[model samples]
Target: MKQFNTTLMAAMAMAIGLSGAPLAQATTPDNQLVIATSLAQVLSVDPQQGTEPKTQEILAGVYDRLVYSDDAANNTIKPQLAETWEIDNSGITFHLRQAAFASGNQVTARDVAFSLTRLLKLNQSASAYYKSAGYNAQNIDSLVKVIDEKTFRIELTDKVTAEDLLYRLAMGISSIVDSVEVERHVDHDDYGNAWLRTHVAGSGPYTLRRWVPNETVILETNNRFWGDAPAMKRVIMRHVPESQTARLMLERGDVDIANALTAPDVKSFVGNQAFRVEQVKIGGFYVLAMNAGRKPLDNPLVREAIAYGIDYEGITGTILGPYGRQRNVPVPEDWAGAIANPDWSFQPEKAKKLLAQAGYPDGFSLTLKTIAQPPRVDIATALQANLAQIGIRIEIKQGNGADIVSAHRARDFDLLLPQATAIMPNALGAMNDFVTNPDNRLAAKNAGNFVWRSAWDIPELNALRNQASSERDAGKRAELLTTLQEKFVAAKPAVLPMFESFFPIVLQKSLQGYHTNLWSLNRLEHVTKTK
Candidate 1:
């Protein structure tokens, strides 16, 4: 491993920044860390569609949830907006923290209530009260009753587990927002929170300073932050779409950190001594979601054939090289519900047999929709090649992120290579988002419309998921999780779930104290320039 003394590298970078020889050098201040990413803007902070990490960064700064899954500290739910809470026989009661708001208003229980109501209106999956009670936004409007300025009550329609409710609350969508600001722009009846989407007023560590659409978003530190003040003065998230351009910026000392680097591009800095690369295993799963409500997929054998046809090990070894792993289950190993099942392994012979049984000896051509991402593109190519060996012909249709999402929702294509995101740590959360949740646009519905046609239905699966949610016993939950994973594997509703790639933050050696957690929450606090 070729390496340089971090202290020496920091000094050199600082000297270059101070000297101001070039545009990249001059713009990157001693305290400012410029990070580049290819993530296009789908900017709705409503946690229902908040898949992009770029959007998460902005949300992390502008919002504060009652409980944050602190990955930097053993993946525990640390106190944030609600410092702590107590659960009695009646219901859970949160003790509000006195935090300064961005709008200079006092943070209270009313703000929490408003935020939850907004989340319900937006139909966010992260709303724990809704999910546990098996309620939607409309259900929320009826259930939540404000007790006092600091206390609230959720009367469950049915009996709910205490743990399930807590986990749901820990999701990012449950973040508190000011009620007054919400009502200012929201009409009595509207599906969207158009005003709060762009303009934010929350009690977080940083305030949204500027968002120049497709170019860059600048944020400044919240001086009256409730917790420890961040060491860095500001954070600049530059939208550099090209990986080559981002790589060039990092090499030239123009940017401090860059995320979503390609497998080959990472090789450039693996041996370079000027920067430090930190790779974190983000909690997500890459899947080829099939429209099960459609013709061929409606047949169980065809779905199973497609599952068997995927050479997961081959893709990881050849296409992904060192940047990926073949994951069987949707959840990560560190998570609560990762199943250990060897039966779900790839079997080309079984795949071909299933195809023949499904009355297709020579597979038919189907359109596979994907974004213009290098990883997905590579995966598509590999899948096409592998499937061809078993007589499955796949035609690739590439488009922009928004276009792909539209097509996916419309059910225009046969298959899609989109990732599944978890609202919380449990397997139930993952299952609920992808399989159970009706409002989830990417779920069982025929395309984006609410025509449920996914080839999956199980009272047992549903019961297991519900049981896992409220079950307080760790051992029992794990056992139930394994059973649920088996059910999914047996009836491959989605394609083979692949392991998430670890995102590396390549930054100048001078920056320190950056933190990342299991949930992939990147905190910019404690990051200081020593040189």
Candidate 2:
């Protein structure tokens, strides 16, 4: 564990600009792109192990997957390593293009098979992505097969659909590693797991030049890359976690990009000529969940009462006005099969009635937990006032963000405000949270099922999610998803979702060809700081 002492942070802070560094020059250089952002939740570049936004942000440039979202639209996936692919004999087959690693070795089907197999065997957090797609240690060796140097096949079980595999593959977890290089670094059947975590051995356009964990990650363009090299020859990712410091770095010419800007700053930059800001609606929706496995909330009526008492408009329009909008369901509004504008809304009278009917003429007392962040404080305060009218005594407990996440996973709180999102824009991927209990527990391997502590299980709902994922007809799949959401809403097990919020990335006005690729790396191939 590394300790970032005050003196060290101050020194790095000076180097990156928060400590009286000079402001930017009129134009940014083409050979360099500097970014100041927070430390990644996890910095391991290993495809089989890492699972943080920062991890994907950096690794996206260093690894290639079979497919990718056609563009920043992120609504459709297109082939990358596999130029052409099709469903064949109850399995999916990919015909690889002639791709070469940075080391100039041709990529083969054997490399792809080895990469997938390594994940399954290691069973790390990244392995959960493939395990959710129905490949486990028991059958992974048989399911992933190489037909030739250029052909690869994945046989799916009845539980996993071809679409599910495609959606999962497009994510960072499916990043293809160079089998030839990784073998040289293998240690005690660890399969280079320890070395890969800190090294780059992929065929992507950028090769890591230096990574001083918790400080900086410097990448230089791979001149030997198989494709056109990134326009920005060198990218310096400096660690500047403080929002104010990152802003200072960006305001100066010290960095080309500053991410996670405060909402007020993001708004201020909107019409500014010198800087441009991008704030896209990602799937990290803000919601409240109740403990269905515990006392009073185990009753659906109580959960319903809590839901109806929340003021969605007050939270989104007031606290998060510039940053977010109200969202009714778990799936994001624009994603495929999203159930937009559902039957539920904030109703105070209905909440009072439900509480009385639950045999609690006087609303019961319970604690509401939230991260100590200012936004969560605002939203929880709003919720407290709304629920008081219905006789509910709300006690607010604020803790660290990481601690809150652990509590959610452990089912440690009575009521908690947490963000929920489908790992990607997939319908089945979103429902993996609430539908698992013990009976239909297929997607439990998927990450971030925070509300799962309630032990809520519905066999029918699980079947519906599984069925909907495999449904080829978009209309039918959408209908099934609607039914699932309606069922969950009716049951009242979750902390009712208030709104979908957003974060901002600030860049120079001349920085072109950049879009928010939410689930993968922030691609920098065509990005150039303009004059």
Candidate 3:
């Protein structure tokens, strides 16, 4: 392994505003794993509060859920904190293994019960999963109960099936926290929400050592972890927002992994012997969401015209390259309910005719908001050109992912270009956000629901979504969802899905056993480094 100069390490530490002792060594140590990626959207590490991808990745290393979805495409899961579980018509019972937290406290059924109860009590974005299953703050105590010291039970509601419920339990929202440690820090009945944002209290392979906002996050191996010990003693995640900078650092061996590389940078290391480039298909889609409540977009004709005007083939082939593929359907193709090759094509003439029929021979102008990142920015520029061809003028607005997401949540944009990922592996995860909008009122502030954010309300489609979610038979549920998608496409809904994403990552050749699935649970316990 290459070693870095002491002066360089000191200088770099000072540049990122690190205080106290200077970095002793700058080299990639055998016992340490260094990753370079953008943490711009990571606001909190709390499992219940974090909704961004980066935050979820961090929490995956620091906490363990009762169950884990190892292969989301196949809809399969494996036990994590819970050694085994049994399911009946009423509810599911989990048999937890004998484990201890980093604080040396025993993991008990009470902790499991309390963790779920706390999630409902906090009423954060993550609570949406439980809420959909009919587990609310008022009903959580009875629904989630402790059977014994090592046994826990969660009653099922008529709103969801046991199979769908398992997928939800596998998500980060169901991560089990050390209740004793969290209760100790609770203040003013906040349920440790304030403290957990910056701290971690869980029984995973790694524990939070230090976090420096948008600069860095350091994690140390948990000595008391019940699972297999991690190969690296420490994992250092540095915030390198620029793709070129991350690429340069990876080339110089300053980091072992670079996750935020652009398509061009990723291709640069394609066949290099020193690096291995991986492209994994994840469950997400790049969408162009139109505000249905807005002026001209309120008409279905306008939304259909906008959808027809997009050059899906051009954008996916050029800008996306190896990063994504064109997918018109809202659901990911790998999921069970996904439609196979729905009827959609790029026709500028068709779009113009629709616009003319909508009483606008001369297309109106509107602003399109998008994240200021590679592919997305490039995609937006392509969309701008495509719409202009049909007489519709599109003004492009760019900002960081956090700012763009905030604007979408506030319902403050005409059109939005953003990637939407399913919270769970189940098809309901995507339908819940993209198709269902329980409340369309602006005062509801339901940022979790993408349909609500777009001000889209279709009772017929919403009714089908509800039926699909509650159907106990898998085959019947798939049929219902297919019908819902067919109707959704025919209605010209506000959200237009352009392409599905494929996450590309570059890692050192010496790194082994690193795996990430559709949900982006970057588990590191099984990973090792060869010096």
- Name the best candidate (by lDDT): 3
lDDT of 1 by residue, 1-531 (tens): 112123322322333445666443433787777888755644565443354556777777777877777766655677777777877655677877778687778788877777777666665323433654565666777767677876766654443555556655666566677676666676555433666666677778777787776678887888767878886678888878777888888777678887756667765565455677666655567777777657677678887888778788878776664455777676676566677644544688888899889998777777888887657888999888878888878999888777887776566668888766665556665555344433333443423221222333444655666676656677887787778777866766644466555555666666677776544446676778766
Instruction: Give per-residue CA lDDT, model 3, range 407-432, as digits (tens).
Output: 99888999998777776665667766
lDDT of 2 by residue, 29-103 (tens): 777888887553445779777765667778888888988865455558787888999985478999998878887
Q: Which ten residues in a row have the lowest lDDT in candidate 3?
A: 1-10
Residue 368 displacement in candidate 2 (angstroms): 5.3
Best by TM-score: 3
Q: How many pairs collide in each candidate, listed in order?
A: 3, 5, 0
Return whichever of 2 and 3 wins on lDDT.
Answer: 3
**lDDT, residue 112, candidate 1:** 77
RMSD of each: 4.5, 6.9, 6.3
The estimated TM-scores of all candidates read 0.86, 0.82, 0.91
Candidate 3 deviant stretches above 4 angstroms? 1-27, 72-75, 334-337
